[model samples]
Target: MLLLVVSDNCQNTLPVELLSEVEINVDCSNPDSDDLIGYIERTYVVQDAEGNISDPVTQTITLERVTIGAIARPADIIFPFDTISCSSGYATDEFGNPDVSVTGVPTTIQENYDQASAIFDYIDISVPGNLILIGDDESVDVDLGASFPLFDMTFNVISVNTNGFISTASGDAVPDSECPLSLDPNSLANTNGARIYALQDDLSADTTEDALAGVYYEYMTESPILTPSGMLTGVSIFQWKVDHLEASGDYDLDFQALLFDNGEITFQYNEIGTEMGSEATVGIQSFAMDDNTTPLHATTISCNTPNSVNSLSAVGLIPPTMGGIDLYPFPEGVSCNGYSQYNDQIVYTDSCMTKILRTFTIGEWRCNDINERYFNQMIDIMDVEGPTMDQLTDITVSTEPFSCEANVLLPAISPDDDCNKADIVIDIEYEVGSRIENAIGDVIVEMPLGIYTVTYIATDKCGNESRMSFTVTVIDAVAPTAICDADQISVGYDPSFFTAVALDNGSFDDCGPVTLAIARTDDPGYPDLAIFTDELEFGCMDIGNTYEVALLVTDTANNTSICTSNLMIEDGIAPFFADIPEDITIDCTEDIDTYPFDNPTVVDNCDLPDAFTVSLDTIDINLCGESMIERVFTINDSDVSDVQLIQINFVNQLAVTGTIDDSPVEGCDASDAPAQTTVSGLVELDGDLLISDACVELTVTSSDASTGTCP
Candidate 1:
């Protein structure tokens, strides 16, 4: 169930009533004129069948109006009522007249000038300045002492025109064309380089009065006007104090153009006579006159209108009319022509020459829920500072001795700015003939041998940029490197195999291709008797001999280097007996002197067999009946030797034969019995007798003949 309590004042003890649905309507009207016409607060609470009650919620009701007769009146407005009849006690509602109030709010104007257009200060250079020109439609060249940037180009000299403009072209003396300049780049009025027209018109300068009617200028090392970024120090002021070329009307104009070091320009007018800028051109033209096809982009503040200031002020307020509130118009007679001594200034905000004006209305007044009046607001912003960097010098280096490129140490560069220094960006660009192989901070590798141009461009957050350039000259000065094998190189005794290329380990030139040459060097007291030719030729005598060799390496730049190495002509194969005879054994008795044995034929890899010497010797060993002989044959090729052996034997044969006669003696016990027998034979060798005398004697074994007689 829902419970609601209603009260004119919020009180917890008010009587509670049950609500049928979730929504409720409240009556907020005063019944009588003396009743309070305010808010009536109501408190609500909900409870369930379980005796649980929710937190109380309160709501306010407003009684802002009172109804009388058929009209409803605002509750805050009260009117006195009179009773028409005392018995009925009824009165008629009275209505009040419509009234309005208005108030004026000052109009506010704001401007945000970019880096190129924030210069607004003006300096009078007409007096105490150099009067360079004093004639009609005349121009002169003047030195600016320091570089001034304009249209992305820097200039140290300017051409001053008596018609109220300056040109950055070198030696420019041509006056601009007639007034009301066209936007065409090929027009005679739009000359070369950048042009700043403070006031361009048909004007003439009197020659006698140097100070009163001539083109005057002064270059200041320090600027008179304080800049917002404080980075623009140098200033060049060119002022024109001349009379317009008119027949009888007063057409005197005084204006000056200020050029800042940061490429910002400002035009200020001090006094404008009756002519004003009726036929004058006041603006800045970018550098595009060189090409006829390119359109001239200019910041034309005014073509032929009167010069004016960028300011806003409120005129008298216009009261609300029957239909709508009238808006106030701009103030009249607020230009240089209306005011004789007008001090008007025009600022170029960016390279595109954009002019921003911000207006705001504040503090509004309302009548019958309608806005009646408000104040206006204006804000101006300025930021025009370019980045700066240290100067860079040219670099010169040589390529590596063994390489075609050099590892150059690049200098580090950092750019700084007065504003937005951390947001500055640096871009590096190479010239047409320059290239980079590899890069790291402080070290760059593989730069070829040539001159290179490098440019550094630094830009800050405001699009203001600064640039610098330097040259890098890489030269070829170091000699080539000649390397030879550490160990001796062995080759066959041939000139083709023992060359400079074969003996070279790794020889090279860093910058280009290299040529190699080989020559044999002479060493005193060497063991070999070999002669060498200029082409490194050696005879067979040079085999198994080593000689010193020199390797020369030369580069395209004529740089040469020499290294020494040992060259050996090796003869590793030994001579062998080509037709050697097999070993044979023979008897010593045979004619060994006529054995028909000779030295064996010899063959060698690098030596002829005719250059070899052979020798033979016999060795014998005697036995009881035979003798053995060894015939050793040796062959020498001077560097190596070979040997072969044959064996021979001689056998000795001799025999002796004899016969004996038997004899017996009587007596077995006879110790001395005499029995003798004699025999003779011949001793012979190989069937030839050498001796013929022989003798033999025999003794009885058992005395058998004497024993039988005794029994």
Candidate 2:
């Protein structure tokens, strides 16, 4: 609606209608784009040291405002009461004569111009002048039409109702000449009742072309055929229904139909001789048809059997009140959806039977007829007593007057905000009168998995009581299962352990969470004990160690469900520098060779062993107190006997504290004198080995053939 580019330094103002969006492209390399730099530096009216509330600088030439408008028309008329009264839906109060000088005048003008038009106004802080709206350089001045004219031209008033729709004639207490009516139509100032009508072209319904006279209901009489003989009136509707359709295979359609003047009629179900049932429908048709055909728009109601028109797909629950199933939820848009108040009329049954009456008032707008009515059918389901923790509740039901599935029982725990709470137990003593024909199995029924009835009586000194019963049943079911994609993943951390997590397929039995137990089979320490309250948590496993992840899932009936695997660990990681001998001091400066050193042991805990690959050796060069000697030795790989590093720290057998080469290398025998025994092939090591003032060379070699030392 407005272009809101505001700046703190510039005067604040807004054009109610945006004209254009201006954008300056900075090449970042061009000097002509200096305005782009200033644009970024300029502070806006909504910008502060804290934050920016204004829209980001969104400037482009293509952005512009489009104009839209709505129009209104004014009118004046005269009434036949000698004074005109405004009757448009907007004019709530009547206005009398404004000027006393025209006291005899009967005409009046009624126009609500405020809401019938559009407006745009704002206060400007930039300049002391009226704002100008520029549309493509064409400035539209707001002051040009500061005040709007009441009407464009003079017009005559005339009524056009109760006749034809085609018209161009106009008038004021007279019709327009363009539309030549045989005579003048009725108007507010005219002698008859007539008003202009707006044609509804979008609607498809047929409306009365002319004014309707009247409507009445009547009855016919053949004997006394005269002027309005019966004066037909009070067209009434009839309705009825049955108590137990499966008992006598009949409908007890006892109805209470209200008619004209709050009158009523009760239609008793007289179909006691009718056996209305078939293989398809448990119940058959009734008085739905009149004169061999059903009334207009009348629907049929029947007790659904298998494969019938009103087929019962989901009837009462199978293990009715046997399994621990919760209550049913209310349908959408119903007043009972979350109705937590005790004053509410509805009650959910133990067998999950939602006992409710979807009642409604059918009106003329909905029925569209004089004698119209609506009927509500009763469906056979589990008794709507209340909720129960367990299906078979042991209670004392009397036998005074017994009605099958009468929704009679003890109180439930509660359906208060806490959904997890179970039902409550109470003293349920009842008197029931039985129907011999409706007796299912026996007075002492043996129910497999559902809530059953056991009739009995407990009368001491008081009078005899009616038939009573107790509900009993059996239980215990299978649990659920879990599945993972892979049997086992190797612990070599591609950093992926959760990706291989086992999933609960939730293949629960009819017992549901009861028969199920969840746990982590990988670690025996973590076990899921609770039914629905259990969850398996698996900790992270790394690459070095092999792991055995597992799960122990079972049902309430103690069914063992398990899945496990053994994973292998990975090898080959980056090798760190284990050890290198610290200070090796050479006493004399000779050839300065023989760089023989051993490495410290490289240990790791990665489940698997690590092998070392020696790289190029490092050597430090010395250039002090030198006789200017250049020493180097070419030792071949073939000359090296041991590939493994040797830990040689001691110098001699006597602990004489010499060097490592001083150890026994040449062979000595008792047959020969120890004093005469000599060392041979004593050579120096290679490389620039020196310790400042000391440097020596020695290369020790061993052979079976010995010779004397020549140092």
Candidate 3:
């Protein structure tokens, strides 16, 4: 069904992909007669795989001149068996992805299929002998097909039966080599029930649209009929010539061959396979097979002869027939250079260096034997990204005082090629740009407060360097504690210094936790000395000079802390305690109007009659914070809010040493009178202002007695 129609619009190219079977519907109304040159332009259409009708591919169907090449067997058939076709392979997309491309096809579908099938079909599959072939084992064969391509063949067995014994019965599609050993030509040539099938494609022509693909093929006995009792099977060779290739000159080549000994019978599966394959071969060769072994075996043989008919003729012969190849006008005998082992390491050499040939151990393999032969030239190079990088975990950070965190993935360590010339070594950088500061150790650094940059750098096994950079910003912490309230003296006031004390009640920690620190701003390095007494109020001092002190408080983590306070000193007069009236009786006061505090009073000294009187009065108090009983009394003239000075000096009356000149600082200056002119009930010297000079022992300003030192 092959119809090759060339258009004036298209040049040398042929429709390779267009070659396929297309079912046709006959218009029975037309006369059932063959019209050679009839002109009837009725709109005849052709339907595609999707059932879309297209204008019929107008072509005159007729017999194509056929030619047979001096070749044999399977899978594909070339157009001009001896001439290479210059064409590009066809490729189609599947699901938007590229799939495998259909390589160039060799037309002249004769023994090509036989060859391909022989190699793949017999893989693990038993060739059926046509008749009671109710069931045939195709699993091993099909599975093998998954790893290779299978072929279709028509075998003619003459010597073996289903019982695995020699038989006189014949079967279609049988291999003569499957007979008993006494029938194999190699070890013992087989010559029984010689069969000859009709040359399929020659007698019949394409009846459909496809290239009239060969389905029911055959393999009969060839010339020089072999007999079982004949001499040892002569050497058979396979020679291939690649010319006018569409793209390049030379190429990689490989092939597979199978044989059987059916001189006795070829119908069953009781036989074991004879030999396995070496598989890969890269070369141009002259010979194809060997002999003298069961189940048959062969290896490619090289030739000392050239590729021309002139050279072959000079050697006393034209291309001789080996295996199934007709070297024709080329060299005679050739060989497959040698076999390579599986673990055999190969140093890929440049084509410019060694253009020699090579071969595999076995005879057939689809991937290996792309063509029906073997050669050594450039075809295509292998591809790959090759081993790369992996993963990472656990990151942390800190400063004894300040710190942060950083993390990232580990870079890959492998060579793309093998030159040992990569970039930087294993080093990770911080990102201050994208907010990633450099990782210190196992931490992924967060953005820092200020502006900065970070980048990870790495090198390949080949020393190829690569780096990635990023930005980061580290944040700032809260401000330390400060002195909002200053320390001062309690002068002429109630608890002026007590109110002046800096308390830790204020916010200390700005972020995590707050704390307060109270310290003498004058002497901050020391701790607080204020005693927590009933009179001192948490270590509060009197209104005189006091040493510098403070209280420091910190946060929970004890990382942030501060202190602030100033200790101001002023003149301190001891607390005044009135002396008990000298056995004085206070008149009972039944009414507030009778005992008036303004008219009567209790004093410290009795000698001073004005300061020695006694009086008392009381009022009532209420529950609502009101004083029910207001006890009242009268004291000598003095500012109640002023700092009380201690008039009791060392001698129980006056100053022991230094004198005051009314200057700001005590004991710094001396005037005409160093001791005070008046003194009242002090700590140990309870009486009113002592005017008698005999009462003091120490002198004023110098502690040396001088007459009338006490005023």
Candidate 4:
């Protein structure tokens, strides 16, 4: 636990009693009130659970009293005055006091300039006496015959250089090769005089023909030129027809500088070849010089690089004019010009007042014949407070579905400043971990998933800054999409097992890695089996059967999705009969009531014998007392079948029997005596007979002869 104690006086030893708070109310009406001023001390100490006490730490606070007053106005003075006067010999304050003094603290003044375009008239100066032959890095003096005004100076003679510029004073021209051409006039090395660069570059007047390169100048006393400063009476025209030192054939330059009698100059381009004045300086420069010609300060006019001015066109400086300003203590009715004796007054111009804190003092003098008294009043203006920025809360967002980035719209911030809101500048930047990315606008575009610290800073014109920071958490919340294979997967029954990963076409998650899972959707009629696992097994029953399965995809964010696909178990092999019996033949008299051969073994690649069926078919044919029998055995599963054939032949055999009867032989002695005499024969077949025969014979003639002998 920590304890805070406050006291009005510092303690020689640690105070035993604890004072937690102190309050003091300031009286706004009274600047010297006792309650408005004081000092207090606060002491802090920490104690641990073991009753150990820490050393006391102390902080001191001071309070001060302040008063804000209005501006003092005295009678006999106009409402607003730029300068106070006491022409009546006696001036007094509002309280009638006559002793007074006035003082003013400095204030910062910001100056801004607005410019317009200048106009010019072109004149030709290519005559014979005007032509001067100049070479590389050389200059020639040309007598203008009259004073020409340029940069607050009048010159009767000017030096024209072959390097595309002219100097107002008598001196050798300096070739300025500085790219983008220095904007500071005094920074130009080696040349001190004011210069007009129509095209200042590394130039050459040397060519195949001398006439093609020359410096021409003519000062016309009666030349009239219309300009932004008005119509000028006299003018000096300097033209250069030269070539760049680095250019080849036909790459020439023709430009002119026009110096008006009013100190205004213009540069005109007659014919600017390709890259003629590309890297050249086309502007004016003037250095403020002391009496000894030592450079003191510089002024410059930049027409910018690459010569924005076109051919047949001219660029010049527009003379400045007095702009408007807001004045304090505006003028009132007071005619001081007619007064014989006036009081001295100090006037602070805009250039002299510059600061955020300033004091303005007004004084009045009171004079009665010879005795004088003075009184003064002072007013202060101060601004020490910074702009007020709105507090920002942390932002948490999710990325777009299936995307790694999100587009976040930040809240708009408009800071409130006590001085000027328009002068407040707001900046926004984001940092990831310890690295700063870049300044962003109101919207953070395509912000990837991460934790970022975004800080918004507001700075006022006085350099007072206020900043607020917040965390932006871009999260991944979108689930993965599970895409099952569109086609049904055919798994061979021989392998027995198939994995769930085989069913995934392309399961994806936007943020990171995803895990794939699969389960059987269709009923395989085996609920007790663990068929819903990642790997599924198929057997003889599952062969030629198709089942539905689903794929589940889950992302790191614990978001999941599911899709379904079909799985088919296939068996292409046919069942066969092992140890098939050979074809057999049997006689027709053999018993055919039962099968004579043992059943062949049925072998199936994926099915058991109980799961299949077998059949036996027999056929018999008889031809010409002979019969044949055939036994066909077949075994079949639902998908495939096999067959075996056995043959049995029944053959018919021929047998003959003969009988002779003697009953009819009683009538004929030898013929009937018997069947030997009355012999009768019959043919019978035990099986099948192709042919039969019967015969009988008698001896009646011998018996008739014996009966005739007895008579």
Candidate 5:
């Protein structure tokens, strides 16, 4: 194993076959102490089964670097992590007997340190340190260790960590006239028969020991002392002489003390009761009148007229103004006798002393009231102040859907008061029409929609009150309206084409910005007809039927309204007339002069001849083979118009042959035909049609027996 030894002169290294725990002694930094400051580094060399040395591992120990001088130094502090009774707790020689010290490595190390170990290298004991006594004297440095004999300082032992770091340095102090002295129960109950104890100047919590071994106490009471103006003042004076334990031994005398009210040092003297100021002070008298002890003697003692004292037990006095100081702080298991109210009070009367001076000169004796003197104690209550409320701002909110209740929000309000914020009481009130039925928090409240004035009042225990008001407004709500109408339209025995919107005058909203929608709610009047959105196509529909249409309208608030109208229908249709006989063929073999004619038929919805009028526009009967005729028809209904058509060929007659008597009639002549036929016996159609009035004639042929006109 590799072992490193460090010293102030130099460092040394060596490899050893076997090694146990290595111990290094480090010296403190104090100049007066005979110790060295150094460290030893240890490295473990691993060996295999064959006894061969392997890789070696090493650990480093760091030196403790402590700050010294005016900087706030980390001194030894004892928390008394557990409770210990005063009697046996202070019996231990040091602060913590058998205390637990640093033995293992800390989970984390300080940033300045390169490596860590359970043991420390160097410790700078000269870096000023303190010795603390739990609740006793203020922390005092270890440099004053030489003065421990003067103060009778004592301790069992000090616990140090494996790293040589100490968190607590506790010890007992020697009793003296100055510092580290206190009253046991600091406060005294104003009621009858209240008493307090005193603590030794030494920093020990041993209740069985009394530091005031040669001290004695006396009680006195008197009426108020008046000023030159006889102002009915509240001041009184107390005088006392010095006393001693032994003739030639040193003793602490001429000490100063302050009076208190409800654990607070009293501020005003003459202005006692309700007239006391924020702060006040009393003087401690040091004028010596006589010498009672040998080495040093306290002569005369005086103080400001008004002060607080032990108890109210004298005859004509104000209950003797209850308050007194004993020897030790009230113990945990001890009773306060008749002063149970001040049981847990801890009084450090040493804080009140301004100064303590001692002398070895002997003095002449004139008077001796060393046993007792007179001091005034007053019975006064502390003055209390009231609280104040801050200004409150206004609030506004909107109502929830379909509800009359308005949702209001109030900001946080904090009041300034002598009492705590939680102690201040808050009250809210709403005006007549706006009462809150329910409240979610300090801010959220449910109330009817209306103009309302809210009052917020805050109060404290002192009866001081403050108020503020705000207004809340709620709005009105309503809906929109829709109107639609179906136009009255007339058509023949057929569906009509029209727009529903055209017939509609649109819609109206109570509030503005409304939406309108149109839909055809009419029954299927005709399967061939389709009602497409705003437009409709007139197809096959029942002649005279009325249809109903519906329109839907909605407002921005989602309020809907529907309106409807009717569609009127009628059937006044015109007749349909078509000309069939465009051409008529006639043969002149059966000669005839005149032909009978029949008119084309007309069709109407009623199928009545009287319902329409028909006429042939034009007709021609001549010897020619072809003729033209024009026809016209009119409907009798006033709502419909007449329909008429024209055909070009009226009569198609041809004169092919003539009889012997009618062979070549001279009166009728064949003009266009190449071979001429004379006269016509009868005009008849060969295939298609022949009109009665359709007539044709034949001219004379080449040979004929009978002359003259063929008849």
Candidate 6:
């Protein structure tokens, strides 16, 4: 649901689902013709991301027409009466102090307006009092200056009505042309270019309510002549002839001074226009101001005619002027050949320098006669004080340094503006890296890491601009990093288990490491070592042994790291044999041949055995009944000899004997040897064998033929 409210507290509700926008067109049926003024209130229903509806939010909106106030009133001015003297120099009131005048004192009655809290826009000065008028049609050279001494001139401001009607405070609204002028019926154009002629008035003329008391209006239809000549002394005022004046409305005819030879001033209405309401406007028309160089000589500043006031609001005296007039058949497509006269009216020449005219219609130049009343205020002379000359002081701007953590522009330091003065504008300018920002009073800058500058500019309402600069620096937010490689190692060997030290190949980091320590990971007892200083020790390991060592390095940023390598230990080796045997020899008469070979020696890398062994290689026997032998020794348990060989020999020599009497002793011992002769004998080679097969050629001589036929 949506709710709407009017300025008068009126409420209106509108129901809707999910929608993007809503629009309504209304035609205001206002009773008053004045500008429309009002505001509207709106309430919106909003849904949150959670699908929950929120309370209605309200806001006020102002309504307005597409266009308004086409016409603008001139700003009021109140200073420097009608005249000034050269002996009194002008002072500047740059500060615009309301309590006092430029002389640093209280002001008089004339200056009292300002002290009493009065405000005015600006004042202007015109020279040679009778050449131009202050409040006339825009096309008129109202600001034109005639030759006159600066001291002899007076600066004054004209008061205009809310509708820009010129105040008729002076009686110069009309001129004494010696004849009355009226619209020419026969020469009427289509709402434009109505010709006027002098009429023979049949009665006395009232200066306040006579022929010039009415107003005039003119508007262009299509693309009318816009030549330079057409802009000056032409039918239209300025180049803005279209959609402004319709030739039928009330116009102001202010006073324009035209001095006669006798120094007496007369008035005229060469440029007059209908008063348009605030919404009326004239298109832009450009014109150049001619540089004037006229000489003036002051002589008591004498004047012939005294300034007077005359009101012409009583234009009802001329009833025919209220309605539009007709002016046709005047001329067509005139050339530009200097200025000339036609039918006693101003005319122009063609491009060929030939005089020509164009005929067109005209319309009414007066407002409807509704009995409108008006009053005028006039002041002819007065005295005034000078202006003040105080100036606004310059401002200083500075700021603090910036950082990426904050990521924004820092506030300015010692930033100040002169507050005593009104309408002082302060601005700040920033440059981040290479980009420059628009000038502002203050700002939060969003930028990357770079150097920058800020400038502060202060400008017073009088258009005095001053500037100062400040600097800002933004730092980066990224951190430094490191890269590393694995640790290295080396190997060494000894006869037995030996201590090993780990070697390092080094590591790499963008930032150097503060500490590098290496520890033996394989064995818990091995101590860690500081890298680049000490070597890693792995004591007493077996042959072909290897262990893991880790390298821990830390950088200045407190980032820890580790890498591993190997430590190899080698101790395995073959043992060598020592103390080998030698060959030995013995004669036949020797008693023994067997003897131990010298004990063998074995040397090994890991460990040596306590004993070795020896063995015989061969044994030899000789015919003389002797023997010899060869021996060998070994260190290891293999048949292959670790030590040298040894050889031993043994030999014995002896004679043979025989004995045979054993059996006879039993039978004939008693009988004597002679009687029985049964003697028996044994024959022996060495100590043991008396052979039974030996034929005893014992000729024992008869001996034991009978005893034993032993064969």
Q: Once model 1 is optimally superposed onto the true structure by TM-score, how far is the C-alpha of residue 343 displaced, in angstroms? A: 7.2
TM per candidate comes to: 0.32, 0.18, 0.24, 0.33, 0.26, 0.22
Q: Cα lDDT for residue 653, model 2?
A: 17
Error of 1 at 649 (Å): 6.3
Which segments of model 5 are wrong by more than 4 Å?
1-477, 489-503, 508-550, 555-558, 564-566, 570-614, 619-626, 633-711
| Whole-model Cα lDDT of every candidate shown, in order | 0.53, 0.25, 0.26, 0.55, 0.33, 0.29
Query: Candidate 2: lDDT over CA atoms?
Result: 0.25
TM-score of 4: 0.33
Best by lDDT: 4
Q: After superposition, how far is residue 5 of candidate 1 from its true place, in Å?
A: 99
Query: Per-residue lDDT for 1-711 in model 2, tens only?
Result: 235555554435432223344344323343223323222122223444444345444333321211111011111222211012112212221232212122211111111111111111111111332212111111111111111111111112221211111111222122212221112122123222111211101111111211111111121122111111122233222111222223332222111111111111111122212222222111101111111211211011222222222111111100011111111121222221121100112334232232322221211211111211222222222221222222335743322111122233333222211111233222232333332222222233212333445443322111222234456333333333544323433332334443223333333433334232333344445544432223332222354455554444554545455554454444333323344434343333322345554444443323224334344333333333222222212122222111222222222212112343323344453223222123332232323221121232333333333456534
lDDT of 5 by residue, 319-357 (tens): 112212221222222222211111111122121111111
- Name the lDDT value of residue 147 in candidate 3: 15
The residue-level lDDT of candidate 6 at 308 comes to 17
173-233 per-residue lDDT for model 4 (tens digits): 6666554444343555666666667787788877564555777877777555665455656
Off by over 4 Å in 4: 1-353, 356-388, 423-427, 430-444, 457-467, 484-498, 520-533, 536-550, 564-598, 603-633, 643-711
The deviation in Å at residue 503 for candidate 6 is: 11
Give the per-residue lDDT of model 1 (tens digit) for 234-267: 7777888787777333326667777766666666
Off by over 4 Å in 3: 1-338, 341-485, 489-513, 518-547, 553-557, 560-564, 568-711
Candidate 6 residue-pair clash tally:
47
* Candidate 4 clash figure, as a count: 23
**How far in Å is the alpha carbon of 599 misplaced in model 4?**
3.9
**How are the candidates ranked when ordered by TM-score, highest leading?**
4, 1, 5, 3, 6, 2
